[model samples]
Target: MQPKKNSIIKTLKLSKKKILVFIFFVAALVASFLFVLKDIPESATIGANNYPQSTKIYDRNGKMLYTFYTTKNQTFVSLDKISENLKKATIAIEDRDFYKHGAIDLRGITRAFIYTVFKKQVQGGSTITQQLVKNSLLTPERTITRKIKEIILAFVVEGVYSKDKILEMYLNQVSYGGTAWGVEAASYVYFDKPVERLNLAESAFLAALPEAPSIYSPFGSRPELGKKRQLEVLRRMEEQKYITKDQRREAGEFQLKFSKIQNKISAPHFVFYVKALLVQKYGARAVEQGGLNVTTSLDLDLQNYAQASVAAEISTLERMNVTNGAALIAKPGTGEILAMVGSKDYFDEENDGNVNVVLAKRQPGSSIKPINYAVGLIKGFTAATPFVDEKTCFPNPGRAPYCPLNYDGKFHGVVQMRFALANSFNIPAVKMLKANGLEAMMATASAMGIKTFEDL
Candidate 1:
């Protein structure tokens, strides 16, 4: 009986060993399948084409005066192009164990999953590589299948790219509010300079933007939340030994100088007109999304002078009941518009100040007289040819006779073509147009770059 009992126990132990061996074999098979998946080449390249960059608009002098981009206002920069302070701040705030972890942090994921499942709290455990993979290569739908793909792609990206390269890609691909993408564009948008010029405090502020760009944007309604996030980044940096406590405190107390809001767009209306032209030429999608570089004939110095002059003139004209003014200066030879002032102020929404008068069409008033007289001169009417600015009525089909009057409602009899156009005598200009014929005058105006005229 004792021998039989020992035999039974031995048999049960042998069965348990077989089950454990089978489990180990299945685990090895699953891992080998995952390894095969990782080995398969993916189509997405880690290159500059990952995001749509802004087509920088430069003045003739090569000064970047404006930028054009769609929703994802990305500007790609290498890791070395940014400051070390910014890099450290990003690592401190985003992934404390970045260098120490592999492609994924199993321990952190476990902890986070446990907290989420049981404690009703959520936490992130993804490494920097994971984030890069999720943002650049995968769709944003949160699902088990997508998560699995993210992990696989993260491992694959880690296998292909170095740690530093991955870190740089993450920095450049992340959004930082408004139209800003990447650290360089964000630095310029927030601080109006390159990332290399950022201080510890500014770097901390920027590092805080990636999590919630619009929410933490300094221009948003909750600016204090942005400051709070910035302070948290500084605290993390100090805790991680990237900065000393004193350095962190100093940075925290530093008065952050954010670049003035979106209004810094120089020559706003002119830039918009250029954008419209580009859209017409390249189609809206290509101009907005193709990352084109446009060099224009605009002269910034001239534009500044013109804007100043118009502003001064508007101040004086306001007393004369003129609430706004616009000016355009063009090179006579090339017809290149050198300067354009669209309105008295772009922000004065009450007066419709944002409306660009240079592009708007109204009755030319006496301005059309020059074209009429020029046509008359081209058709045997010399500058000395006589015309009378009298109260002569033009025939009307269904209404009272069409009579034109001068500014003073009095006519100067016997005016030459030059005098009629120079002093803008209304009846003489109308007679000149009639003599030259309306079609001939319209053709002459069209030849002189006046495109707004129509048959109506």
Candidate 2:
């Protein structure tokens, strides 16, 4: 009787403890719900233009170079104006379950949480609605509190707006690299066409950019990566049944011709160089949207003259297979850039004219002969030092012997260093390099501001 009575009391005590735990859980849940509810923003104000003002760039003479803006470049279009292909492509790549899920994807969030905690990889599980809310209403902070607020606002926004409205706003508010702020702007920027005219391939290409504008920009460094990303978007679209397999194959094989940048700016490469510096100093957000009035040291008159000279020279050299040229004029005393022409023409995309060749790494060819001669002179080799410019091979222990030949494929025997340098003889230069020692030449070049050479 006593043992049975003790068992009954133990069961009653366990029931009381379970009830208290349930009550505490419920109380905490109610408190958290109320706390987050107060932070939710008004969903009706989502369409309001809250973007910052444009930053103006000017030359030293106060002439406007460019008006750098993210929002200023935006051209908002109705959802119907945008291409259906682009819409499908965006949905396929960005969020496959956009239509099926609510404001937050619980399953995706759970998976991301598992990856973050167990695999030690932080990942985002934001739905389209959540993204719209975060980009429009919240700061770009990666914090638990901020994420909680983003989730709350996403729910409120979904409740107030339909899915179509949310998608429309998102397409308008998202950035698509450079000064492009919306799909309409991106369409024109990349294809030189309206958003409605983007075909399946073009639409897929643009759809790939919003994931990372700088990385996936066709005009950016490593453009092959952008092509790879476009193919990935097409793959996703096919997997989700948004695009057929044939359409995916065709789109993947399509050659995309990007439009030349058409922003109204003077000395575009110089302007961009200055903008890059500014972005480095101030954050990208501040430089693009902080309304900064930047005055550079560029002389517009010299810039125009240099551009004309380069164009004329390149035209003259066209028959010689020279398709491009660059020029940089600076004040010799102060080293301030008076004019900088990065290429022969900034608008010639076919010839890769947008590439700033002045900054590119290339074999100096005969141009580096002067540096070689200078290093030889420093190492006690006089101008009259005689080098045999005959057929000779420098020995290598494990590789083929480095045999150098002159540009004209004829050698002049026993030439002075000055004459060999003047004529730019390859054999004499190689012989001089061998005598001067590679380490000694590299040290001299480094001191003379030749930065491209790596440690041997």
* Candidate 1 lDDT by residue in tens digits, 198-269: 999999999998888889988989999999999999998999999999999999999999888872677888
Among the numbered candidates, top lDDT falls to 2
RMSD in Å for all candidates:
5.7, 17.0
Q: Give a tens-digit lDDT track for model 2, residues 1-456.
A: 999999999999999999999999999989987786677677778976555646767788987677677746665678999999999998987777888899998887887799899999765688889888888888787878778888888888888888998899999888899878779868867887779999999999999998898998877778988999899899989999888999999999998988886666789889888888999999899887776889888999889999999999999999999999998887877888888899999889998877888778887788888888899888788999999899999998799998999989998999999999999999999888888888887888889878897545
In order, candidate lDDTs are 0.84, 0.86
TM-score of each: 0.73, 0.50
Which residue runs of candidate 1 sit more than 4 Å off their true CA positions? 1-48, 55-70, 95-125, 139-147, 177-179, 211-252, 260-268, 298-325, 344-354, 380-404, 408-419
Q: List the residue pairs that clash in candidate 1.
A: none
